[model samples]
Target: MSKTVTVEVGLGDRAYDILIGSGLIARAGETISARLPGTRVAIVTDENVAASHLEALKSGLESGGVAVAATIALPAGEKTKGFAFLQEVVDAVLGARLERRDAVVALGGGVIGDLAGFAAGIVRRGMDFVQIPTSLLAQVDSSVGGKTGINSARGKNLIGVFHQPKLVLADSGVLDTLPIREFRAGYAELAKYGLIDRPDFFAWLEKNWREVFEGGDARIEAIAEACRAKADVVARDEFETGDRALLNLGHTFGHALEAATAYDGARLVHGEGVAIGMVLAHRFSARLNLASPDDAVRVEAHLKAVGLPTRIADIPGEMPGADKLLDYITQDKKVSRGALTFILTRGIGQSFIAKDVPSSEVLAFLRDSLG
Candidate 1:
């Protein structure tokens, strides 16, 4: 069965849908054939995901009668979002001699989506692309938003565009094959919607987190609902010029932590970093009197309850250097004129962008993050 969650971007001609359901790949051809501009296609996936899901996707497309010109299996991880890898894809897209009207399909996690979407954004000035996110993080978060870019030596997702996908097909069953670590990591992003401005959602998460983590019926329903929530916000603020910024509740610090660790090669997964980042956001929110300490404590407690890191000491190697984190923050996309744009929460389900915060104060907080 399928659950449909449609989010109209309100850009008139630029609106889209984010379809969440089980066994979505079977409908991939139908989804693409219905929305995309051209029949020629390119599928970009990572090596890890390809091993498990690539054939099914390709077969699905063929069975759906859509012509797939090429399928590129990227090396999984944040590292693949760099120049050489992007060039390889560009070569493939161009070598295929695809037209601007031709579509690109992102077939893996956020990394693939960012890289492939960016390639599509630039190739022939732009091409439509579809997102078929295989990981939970991509499903509920990355896949829907048009924001796509790879990591730089400077920061995680620092080099990306506000480009949106043509269609997003998030099949919850895909999570079963995902590594447990990655599934747990994605949950951090999953919980973030609640952290940003959905108190009731967060409450639901707390009540059903264990079941959600287990990836069953409750998990599927909640994941679809969470995607709907995010899609609702994205549809309203496509460029993140307003409320969309709220999506980064833990991500501001989470991105910094991921950059500080260079994605840490299993040492610190993106979601784990966000888990810690949320704790820090809560701490800073409480520290700055924007949130109640009790609420902050509750956030931390919940993060820990789900086996997510909630403190600096929980990070590896003395929790990365404060200076390193500070440096990462410097390169953050939200930084401007030497002041940081932090997504600090007033409490669960309520976050606001705190701009003009001094680097010195942020550094001071990072210092405290070490313990």
Candidate 2:
């Protein structure tokens, strides 16, 4: 019975609502049924999520008289977002005999959302999909944006499409089941919004992050704010042709690290990589005199205080050398016409896209970081 906060992603006819609150999953069937009457749905989730909350979701759907045409549960983790599983999900949806008007429900974290969304986008020339993001990362970021795809052998998210969801249900209550580490990793992305262009929000988070972690009004407010920030950006640049690229703030270096680790969760997760990459982006900006070194230090301090990895050395196990890491960066999707593009900063809340960055400069920075 908690209050629901709704944020709209304005895309003309394609617009949708992101409903944020507690107990949303239990109400998902009713909400979705009202939006697309008589349409059946296929629930695509990961094994971990299926074991935890699938029953509750199913019961909710059944209560609303929504039929689950099929259910496909893949293995959980970053590795699941690849060609093999993508094929598996596509086939499951196809095998279910779901018509074009049917829906695909992504019921887990970013991996499930991305993979299921990609399947929904391509199957039968695209089917309607609803995103019930169970994780903090999915709720605040991936679930809202239309970006969907699997990992490429070359890089993370290199093979995706912009497939916006029909609706997004973010149940803050679900996050209570998240492990502390996973929750903290998600906090990194939440903090990214502040660093991207909301210095005041960043300061607010600095003061109220503890309550956000504890959950309740603070947690819902924080997630809603992050979603609002992203919704505005996505509405302005849905295709990521211009200003939307700013959202890639920490992704360049972060993707490189994820690639180097071979998508090994034990080594690093996406948000952890992003946390470290944001720090690197700031430090590199300082090295180029684009921002003050104090800014980099402050960024690192906040991330670390929240238990996110903020440095190369923070990663567990032996990491690849600078040259190897650089090789991965070259394969990143941000590379344009063989040149590097990065979201660098001039100061807190002052990020801009830097294009055609010299490879030599990046190499030197990587060497220093690796050392």
lDDT of each: 0.81, 0.92
Candidate 2, 139-213: lDDT as tens digits: 999998799999887667889788899999999999999999899989999999999999998999999999999
Model 1 root-mean-square deviation: 2.1
Misplaced by over 4 Å in model 1 are: 1-10, 320-324
C-alpha TM-scores of all predictions = 0.93, 0.97
lDDT of 2: 0.92
> Where does candidate 1 have its weakest 10-residue lDDT segment?
2-11
Question: Which ten contiguous residues of candidate 2 have the minimum total lDDT?
Answer: 152-161
- Tell me the deviation in Å of residue 259 in model 2: 1.9
**lDDT tens digits, residue span 53-122, model 1:** 8888888887877889988998888789998999999899999888888888899988898899999988
Give the C-alpha miss distance for residue 1 in model 2, angstroms. Answer: 2.7
